[model samples]
Target: MAGHDMLRSISRTFKLPEELFSGMPRIEINGDEEVTVENHKGILMYEDEQIQINGGNAVVQIRGRGLRLCTMTRTILTIRGYITGVEFLR
Candidate 1:
């Protein structure tokens, strides 16, 4: 925990994005039709109405309609559909 505290202090001092220091997921939502996730570990589930992503310390669950994996890479993922909800489970 001390290491994390030190990183947090450095981040604040440098005015850097917190996610650059914290191993946490960064999520971006574009209206109700698209979602992007960064710093994600991997996908846990994929379906027409639900998608689950492993986010290291937590899991990102997305629920929607006609869900599709638009893009995915080592650390980034993009989902497209009529997104109804998003949840983070730790």
Candidate 2:
């Protein structure tokens, strides 16, 4: 299993909040117009068609039209536009 998966399983077994470990990325979509991601390392690639950010074991990618950063900080990213797809790539 991936490192993050193992950490998640352990967190579950211990009855701990999954976010405690902070290895897995947390994503929240407020409708298709906005999306938020937590614990992302940084942005690797960005464009209207795609935005890729560094996560622990993989790169988190968001796809859509008129994609914009909107807002970003050390631990979180707020994106605005039509979020067509979300994925992770190694």
Clash pairs, candidate 1, are: none
- Name the lDDT value of residue 85 in candidate 2: 93
Model 2 lDDT vs. the true structure? 0.88
Task: Quickly count the clashes in candidate 2.
Answer: 0
* Error of model 1, residue 10, in angstroms: 4.3
lDDT of each: 0.92, 0.88
TM-score for candidate 2, please give it: 0.88
lDDT (tens digit, per residue) of candidate 2 on 2-86: 6778888889999998876847678999988898999888999999989998887679899999999999999999999988999
Query: What is candidate 1's lDDT per residue for 27-89, written digit by digit as tens?
Result: 999999999999999999999999999987779999999999999999999999999999998
Q: Supply the TM-score for candidate 1.
A: 0.86
Report the poorest 10 consecutive residues by lDDT, candidate 1.
1-10
Give the runs in model 2 whose Cα sits over 4 Å from its true position.
1-5
